[model samples]
Target: MADDEGLSNEVNLQQRHRKERKELQAQVQKLKHSIPKGDKRKKKEITEQIVKLEAELDQKQEKELEELESTTNEPSKVAEQLESLTTVDSDDVDVAHKVKENKPSRAQKRRDKKAQEEKEREKRIQEETINNLMGSRNVESETIKAILDKKGLQLFEIASDGNCLYNAICHQLQQQGTEASNDSLRKQTADYMRAHQDDFLPFLTKDNGDIYTSEDFEKYCVELEKRPVWGGQLEVKALSHVLHKSVEIVQAEGSSLIIGEEGKHCDSPLCIVYHRHAYGLGEHYNSVQPKSEETVDEFT
Candidate 1:
């Protein structure tokens, strides 16, 4: 009975100890709640430990993924290399599906046609400028023909549009890339200007600010010893809005054959280029007007 009593006392003591431990745990939880969370160094250390454990878990997952990929298909690695080196094969049987036909469409053709038309218009303007310049110089057909031949501009081409003699010839030379000397062009241009200065020829405006007319320019032409040669023409259009005002010549008629109007332009018989020579009129001749009556009396 005493032993039994002793066992009961021991059991009671154990139950009390357990109760005390429970109370101590409650007090410990209350104390933890009373302390500020981020203020304590030990709390920071516990958070760091938790983060470290999570990182370790993430590493384990990645290692599993890598292992799985390594155990899978043999071509997985080689597929990347093959894709890098591969080009679409034109000859392969099924490649027709992947091939793209690059022929221009109807719309593209229309655009090209419009572009071609614009180019043709610009080229036409350039040709007209050259013609106008030639016209002003009174350059003759033969001289012009000679220069054209020298420039390798003797050929003709059939244009889908109607072609001009000048355009056809220049086009042929341009296609052949003929070597035309600038000096020749200039010299020929000048020679023509001087020879026909009397015919109210157009000139590149001379140093003097004067304009000449087609008829009255004969007085100046009388001074030229050589017949004029026609060189190609050049039109001086202003880089800006104004266009085609200036003409250029290497030599001028007389001091200047610029014929702004016709005064002495009709003074020619053999030379219809001018109306009449100043010497052509009997009014100016010593035989006709007789210089002066005083000189006539002295002679008598």
Candidate 2:
């Protein structure tokens, strides 16, 4: 019953958000058409309304999706009871046979369709997250693409399903003849952060400038170890320290920052490029591959 309710709620929320967004868009267009172009105050008011509506819609969609995803693993309570009843050793053979009857063919089809929809929904959510995070920085995709080309580097794309950063780092390591996995990296990072709290605590402040307490920091480390949180600068620093490797991030509009303990412990550097709005308005991570000097040695 819970899962059914979750699916129903997800569908309703999606429809509501889409309808509301269209209504807001229509209102904005109507206001624009009615107002004189010279009326700066009226134009500003309309612009503000549009921004507010967009933000509200975005928040609603994100929250609904989160709630839907949380309940996805829960089977309906009725199904569990029915499943338990199937195990009974009843004397009535005919009733047992009926219980053993195959499910309707359409049921399987419905399940398949639901699974596909869930996959697509998750993909859309991830794309939205990337877009929102990168959009805040005013990063441009074309600028980053040009910069990579100028640097003679190619991008090896990673899946943008919340593990792009870890996958990108793994790809970079693999290119250098090393093997790594996302889980291992997450564990190592969390361990490093927990072991050296003082080193990172001074910089862990909320948006309002309140410093994170030790307990809060520990909870964050636990989440990092267990949750699929998108890796950021903090993770980069932690991973660098744990692996004793220098990680270089090439950004579109900012100077590259090197993270790690720079000393004899550092070996070859791993390079990853960050793109803004290049992959469907989302921020993404990709391994930076440079051209080899001895290409065409075999004389094709």
Candidate 3:
């Protein structure tokens, strides 16, 4: 009787485990399709979660199979015990069977329902967040593209590394018959900022809202020159003066910003798009280029 009960428990446990595994597999599928393409960071996070769940499933399955096998091996002993226990009361047998079934009581069922609801709510929230992020990027990209279309220009995508701003500027310069390396641009911008500290120092503030000291400014310049730090409006203004060209920042909304327009060093400006939410990591920039014949035809 004990052997039979042990086998039954093992079978029930395996069934529960299978159900859990199936649910996990469904979650993995949902996650795989939840986000848009080009979101490498989010995809990586989901992949890690899927790997963890699969590992857990494999471990549980192995242990359950071993337990089930051990319980199944004593069939002959179970048969003898069953024959001897035939004289037991039918009502007692029914009660024993009910106990072995291990059905959840009302309290457990309520708790389980509440937990499942909470899990579902969390999943919904995750899906919504990803959708919102992707939607915002799509809208912003489209808006910027519309503006570029008026000028016969389109977005030239740049890598999302910290050097996107410098890379974009280099791409524009190269298109204009000026080949400048990103490293050189960074150094030039830093040097320009260092030389004109008064022009930039007033705009910079510490964490406590105090003006940056000379030492703080030096460290900032070093970070720009040696590190892959992201460049912002300050760096853009410095680059405009360094490159002797007005830098125009196009955006999805509001009027475009033209830096160093007073310099009037060139007939045309170096155009770049500024994205606030296009990339999940943070702000990004892409070069604006004139459309080629093939691209123009496709757009038409």
How well does candidate 2 score on lDDT at residue 74?
53
Listed in order, each prediction's TM-score against the native is 0.16, 0.49, 0.63
lDDT values, one for every candidate: 0.35, 0.73, 0.82
Q: Write the per-residue lDDT of candidate 1 for residues 154-225, one digit (tens) a residue.
A: 212122111121222232233345433323333343344555454225553445766655443443333221
Number of colliding residue pairs in model 2: 1
lDDT of 2 at 229: 70
Query: 94-188, model 3: which lDDT tens digit per residue?
Result: 88768856976434565587589879999999998888767977889888989999989988888677888998998888778998887899999
Worst 10 residues of 3 by lDDT: 291-300
Relative to the true structure, candidate 1 reaches a TM of 0.16
Worst 10 residues of 2 by lDDT: 291-300
What is the per-residue lDDT of model 2 for residues 240-263, given as tens digits with 9 covering 90 to 100?
A: 877778998888778877887474
lDDT of 3: 0.82
- The reply for model 3, stretches above 4 Å from the true place, is 1-81, 90-142, 149-157, 279-281, 289-300
* Top-lDDT structure, candidate number: 3
Q: Rank by lDDT, descending?
A: 3, 2, 1
List candidate 1 stretches off by more than 4 Å: 1-100, 137-300
Could you tell me the lDDT of residue 275 within candidate 1? Answer: 9
